[model samples]
Target: MTDYGHDLLFGTFTTPSAQGAQHVLDLAVTADRAGLDLVTFQDHPYQPAFLDTWTLLAYVAARTERIRVSGNVLSLPLRPPAVLARAAASLDVLSGGRFELGLGAGAFWDGVAAMGGRRLTPGQGVEALREAITIIRDVWDTEAVGGVRQDGRYYQVVGARRGPRPAHDIDIWVGSYRPRMLALTGAMADGWLPTIEYLPRGVASLPGLNARIDEAAEAAGRSPRDVRRLMNFMNVSFSPDDDGLLAGPPARWVEQLADLALTHGVTAFFIGGDDAGAIERYAAEVAPAVREIVSRERGHYGSMP
Candidate 1:
C-alpha cells in the first residue's frame, strides 16, 4: 500500500496581487468560510506586482476565523531564519496556531541579488536551507532557555535568544525539486512540498523521488513517515474528455487525488488557481470525495492480513 498514514489536507494557492490585494484577501476569507484547510499565497518579494506575502498572511489570519495561512514557499534568501522564526511564532500565536511555514531556498537569483541578498549556486542553496531549518527549529524551542547557536558555511546563529513558541507545532514544508534538497527535506523538514510543474517526469517519477527521501530519512534515524508528502497541481479542468492531469470534473479530481494518496503516499494537496469558483468546487466536492476514497482504501489496507 502506498498510504503513509498521514491525515488528508486540502488547500488553495492564491496569488498576492498588489493591484488586487482585496480580491485576493477576499478569496482567502472565502476559502476559510468554505471549510478549506489552508490558504497559501506565493512570495515574490522583488516582484513589484505582488503584495508582501507575510503582511498579507497576517491580515488574512485576522480576517478569517479558521484556515491556515502561509507563503506557498517563502523566499529564505530574503527572509533571515533568525527574525523569521520570531515572526512565524508570533503569527502562530496571534492566529491561534493556524499557520504553517513553507520555504524555498531561493528563486530568481538575479532578483534576489538585486534585493541585496546573496546569490547562491544550487549546492550552496541546499546547504543554506539545511542550516536555516536547524536554526528555525531551535529558535522555536521555548522549553530551552538558552540562546540559539549554530555555525555553518551558509547560515549561522550565535547566542540568539529563543522563545515565543508557536501555539502549535508548525510544520516546515520545503518546496524542493533537486536531489540534495529532497535529502535535506527528508532529514530535517516536517513535509516535502513540490509542484507537478517542476516534476518533469510527472507522477511516474514519484516513486523514485520518494525512495530518495525515505533513504535520507532512514539515514537520519527518523521514520520515513515523519515527513509528509505535499504536492500542488497548477490547474484542473472539468473536461471529461481530457486525459490530462487533474483534468475533468469533480469526479475526475477525486480519482486523481485519491490515486496520489493511495499510490504515491501524498497526503496534502494544494490546488493552484485564484478563481473563487474553482476553490469552492474543490472544497465543496472534490475534497470530500477524495477523503472518502482514501478512507475506504485505508480501511481495506488495514484489514489485510
Candidate 2:
C-alpha cells in the first residue's frame, strides 16, 4: 500500500464552453455550493469554442466564495512562465488563497504553432517545462535577495522583479504522463495530475509509472511522499450496475477510490463532466465515503505498532 496520508480532495473538471458561458459559471458555482474542494476547467487557448481559461478562472474565483479554481492543465507554450507566476500569485491573493496552478508542457503542436507559440519536440517540451518551473518558483520567491535570473535555453528571465507574494504557498500540480515528465513531477512538482483515459494501460499502469516518479524523487533527495498523487476520471457514471472502473454506483466508486488512495496514494480525485446532478451526487456520496474508508484504513495501519 502507498498511502501518503494526505487529506482527500474531490473536485469537478468542467469544460469552459464559450457558448454556454452562463452554464459554465453555474457549474463552478454548483461545485462550490455542493462543497467540492476544487473547480477546474480545461484550457485550450487555440480552441475558439472555449472561454479563455485564465479569464474564466479569475471570474470564477470572484463568483465563488470558497472553492479553489484552476485550469485542468494550462498549456505552457502560450503562457510565459514569469507572467504566469505573477498572474498565479495575484489570483491567489485576490481569491483568498483559493488558486492552484495546474501546468502542462505544451501538447497539440499544430494549435500551439498556430498561436505563435513554439512547436517543440517531445524532449524539447520537457526541457522547456523544467526551465519554466524553475523560473516560476524563482518569481514566487519574493523574499529572495535579488530579482529572478535564469538564462535557460527555452526561457530567459534577466533579473525580473518578483513581488506581490501569494496569499498562501500555492501548489504547482503538473499534468504529466511520459517517463521524463513523470520524473520531472517527482523531482519538482507539488502534485501529479494525470487523466485516467490517457494512461496506456489504464489503472494497471500506475504502479510502474509511480515507481519511476518515486525513483526520481529519491534521486532528487526528496521523499516520494512529497509528491501528492491526483487523478482525473473523465468517464464517471453514477449508475446501478458495475460497468467499469468509475461507471458503477456511488458505493462502487467509494470502494474503487478508497483502494486507489490506499494502494496508489491518490489523495485527490477530479471527475470530468458538465452534469450538475452527477457532480452533486459525487460530492454528497462518493467523496465522503471514500474519505471515511481511507481514513479508517490509514488509522488501522498507523496503529499497527
Q: CA shift at 110, candidate 2, in angstroms?
A: 0.2
Q: For residues 1-305, what per-residue lDDT tens digits would candidate 2 score against the true structure? A: 77777889999989899999999999999999999999998889999999999999999999999999888899999999999999999999999999999999989999999999999999999999999999999998999999999999999999999967999999999999999999999999999999999999988998998898899998999988888899999988888899999898889999999998888888899998789999999999888899888888887885111
Question: Global CA lDDT of candidate 2, please?
Answer: 0.92
RMSD of each: 1.6, 1.4
lDDT of each: 0.89, 0.92
Q: Could you give candidate 1's per-residue lDDT for residues 185-298 as a string of tens digits?
A: 899989999988789798988998998998899899998888899988877666657577878877878888999998999999987778888888888989999999999988
Off by over 4 Å in 1: 303-305
Evaluated with TM-score, which candidate comes out highest? 2
Clashes of each: 0, 0
Deviation from native of the Cα of residue 118 in model 1, angstroms:
0.2
